[model samples]
Target: MSIEVANDANAYLGMKTLDTPNSNNYVEYDGNGHLTIDVGEHDDFDGPDTQPGEGVNSDSFTWFDGMFQLCNQGKAEANISYELPDPPAERDIPGNWTAPGDGYDEQVVGFYYISEGGDDPGEEGDRIFVPEGDSVPLPVGECREMGVRTVTKGVDATTDAPLIDGDVVVTADSPAAGAPNGTDPS
Candidate 1:
């Protein structure tokens, strides 16, 4: 997970791998929207790709949370958001995005936000939000572990990497603006 800067002038994100390098691999943020939680898979003998990445797991599709330690250095906190943008995307993946029929468990590939080590409250289409400035702990430089359940799944003959139907949105907003929060759109 990447630490977001709500007040860029004051806020900063910082981390170094956890003490256990073997299990907790640390990576510097590279502005690509994440850190320390990259995963991959390849056909055996054909390749594990050009590189055998760190923290190799038996299954390539699931990354259990606890891979992030975001240091909040600003007054505002960062909560993940999953609202689709306005005006829509010009070119989006084409497919039947809804259930093929009743009771069908349609494919799901997304960032499942974790709250207090339990199932995401957002799965029902409503999400939770911390009050203004509650996201960042007091005493600047204080670090908070942000846990996100990264889910990937295979859909019949679709791309080997699941085609993303939504975006992992992170944004900067104000505490008084009543943000770092979400409400049912309807």
Candidate 2:
């Protein structure tokens, strides 16, 4: 995420031009008319501020069914399918001695999918699991969100491992099922 794209990135953090090999974590996009939404990542690490697991973060209780949705992250309702990985959320650590974040997923990660309960619309309140191969259209300015099951160390983490990665494609709209002459009616 670039400082320009970060949801509340420090606006006054002046820099002497981020150029060349000195710039860390930089990517360039060609912008060929894609539904690429800048992840508004409105959340930040509340260190040790962890939410209790839904009883599936342990071997003694290894069952969980949850719902997730796609947020607008744009100015209009859009239908797009994208396979993205867990956000790279890095946190502060004490001292130079360190540990890597891997193999500890069950304790620190959450998995999300279109569970069979998706047919029930939602598991809790407005949190609906994504429909199979589909999305629940988001209103403009919605914050995109997702979850993935992983194991981890309690409270804190250092590095982030890749979860899911793929391309994003926006399909065209189709005519209403009973449209006459295959033409959509406003």
Candidate 3:
């Protein structure tokens, strides 16, 4: 999986991992505040590079990409959006090609805001299994910590928790300080 973070300031941060077989892993966001986390796969290939009927011929291709925004602008909220692969039954399968199941299943993505200097997670400020494409508004206060996690359906919810967890200090915007006007004090 790959992870990228960006904001209005033009600052960018990113992380990625090589695709491993049958391994479940994820990236976390541990930054200051007001950043978006883009998660998905890149350049996934399923068929051989040879001519069709001469080599392996896959019937269909599929992939997923999405972005979740953690904003503290007017109100602390997490805006989530993602483009998931359509159902296999709905896709067009090419003739004279083998269409292997994409193995794409419904999963749950979660986001939360933790209290400053706190270790235990309470019932408050926790958005569990957030809708696939929706925004979750946070409580009325500064969020000092933020976390993200993904889990496959029908699995233990606590397993494979957030691999990325860190502090985040949301700061309100303010006007730039003006240069010292004519008066010289000392």
Candidate 4:
């Protein structure tokens, strides 16, 4: 499986870009039915530091970007697990500011499935709340196209700073035909 982080203009950090792996992006499911990817820190920024008592600078913002793909190598289906981090709050924002932080009330990390024709899967896609965790199922011999993103609630989709994102692919061998696929295959 291969994953590509979108290169949108708004998602770019001043001097710190996503430190994605140069190779080995594919995630294999272990016998325990779980796969984990550790996406390290936010990019390094070359911006002015705010001194004590100084207010928040408009340029000092958090940014987020992510995407993933699932490749089923086995004859059985499987589920992919991922957890989204909570949206930034007044306390989460890093700066010497006295004003309240612009909290993202309904922020979410969306996982969209793309059809063979490269069209959006629409309602069939998954949208998980930030700071929450969930999983999605993938069929055997199926290669699914998916796009992951972070956005604030109610407002248009925009990237934020101080964000970290990653993914994991899980599979179960010998899954009963037509049975549910995931970490808990009950």
Candidate 5:
């Protein structure tokens, strides 16, 4: 699961893993879209080519949507990536996304972006805005349906539980309370 946190001015992205050193791992952010992680030397290993004089560098690179690009030896093949979607990505309405239903059954939802002028909502776009004491409709389309569900905070209901704010939400579309009412786009 992915978790997003606000630290001073940065947005720290944390993840859960049973393989890594810590059951949970986190990347430090600096707001300018930079994330830094310090895994011990034991965590990194050389694959094939290595020179006597050249020393391996320990560094972390940040990519779009919080993807961390790690490079060992100054080569493309030496690079590896770990991607974690930013808490919110600007998804066009009527697009496809994963939703969770009761018993944790995953469902696909087609959402229509609703705005003041029916235009594209800017960056961090047209997502289900869950406001306190308010009901929000699910984005419905040929891909999914419409429903009223409370957005999960820092919880990936499809994967992991809550840890922090800005986590991917889990939306259920079954016969339960927030099940989406589907519609045709044609």
Candidate 6:
């Protein structure tokens, strides 16, 4: 089990340069009821000191239930300090990445699809929130390319894993956020 953090201060940190590469990191749900992500940090437009706060770093238990279709990461009454993991060596941005949510004009740090109604509408396992504006329904897996900085970590099931360029298929029994007529799911 691992603890993750996504602080608000780090969501939107700076301007995306004209030549900047579109984020390749994303999350996906495998058609067989599993959501997997290639872990990494946000695009660091600002330096570490100016980046979002660190996450609590401590020993914790992390678990994912296939039956209930949930994923959890948290410390038992411990605060885990978090630091942005160093980006890959070849990228244009080379420091800890902050949240685009905090630095940019848009309220959404990234993009995601929320579940409208189902067995677990808001529950982590049953509901689905795609981080980068890819809209689809649950149980219907799709590859979405998106990114978001760590908002806050240490709390139970708060921050998701650092995702790299990869594929995920939503297999859990979750109803997509926008359904029928494009109404907000929350």
TM-score of candidate 2 on Cα atoms, chains taken together: 0.27
Could you give candidate 1's per-residue lDDT for residues 50-154 as a string of tens digits? 654433222134433444454545444433233322312332222433223334433222333234423444444332333212232223445544433321222
TM-score of 6: 0.19
Displacement of residue 122 (Cα, Å) in model 6 is 19
Residue 102 C-alpha lDDT in model 4 = 54
Model 2 per-residue lDDT tens digits across residues 1-186:
443442211111111112222111121123432222221121332224674222223222121232123344433444433333333345221122112343332323222434334343555334333322454443344433333333323324223422213343323233332366433456
Candidate 6 lDDT over residue span 1-186, tens digit each: 854443321111111211112222223334443333422344542334565323322223222111112221111111111123343343322133322332332221123322334543475433243433233332222211223333322222333433223342322223222354323344
lDDT of 5 by residue, 128-171 (tens): 33232232322221111111222222224233222112423322
TM-score per model over all chains: 0.40, 0.27, 0.26, 0.36, 0.16, 0.19
Each model's RMSD to truth, in Å? 9.9, 14.5, 15.9, 12.7, 20.8, 18.5
Runs in model 1 lying further than 4 Å from the true structure = 1-28, 31-37, 42-63, 76-107, 112-143, 148-154, 162-168, 177-186
lDDT scores of the candidates, listed in order: 0.35, 0.31, 0.31, 0.36, 0.25, 0.28
Candidate structures ordered by TM-score, highest first: 1, 4, 2, 3, 6, 5
Q: Which stretches of model 3 miss by more than 4 angstroms?
A: 1-69, 74-122, 125-127, 138-145, 153-186
Give me the runs in candidate 5 sitting further than 4 Å from their true place.
1-129, 132-134, 142-168, 174-186
Query: Which regions of candidate 2 fall more than 4 Å away from where they truly are?
Result: 1-73, 84-120, 123-127, 150-186
Give me the overall lDDT of model 1: 0.35
**Pairs clashing in candidate 3?**
none
Best-fitting candidate, scored by lDDT: 4
Model 6: ten consecutive residues of lowest lDDT: 72-81
Error of 5 at 145 (Å): 16
lDDT of 4 by residue, 1-186 (tens): 864442221111101112233112222234443433322322332234632221112323322222334455444655554444433452242222122235543324344444443232334334322223344555666655444443432322233443333332232334444455433346
Task: Give per-residue lDDT, candidate 2, residue 180.
Answer: 60
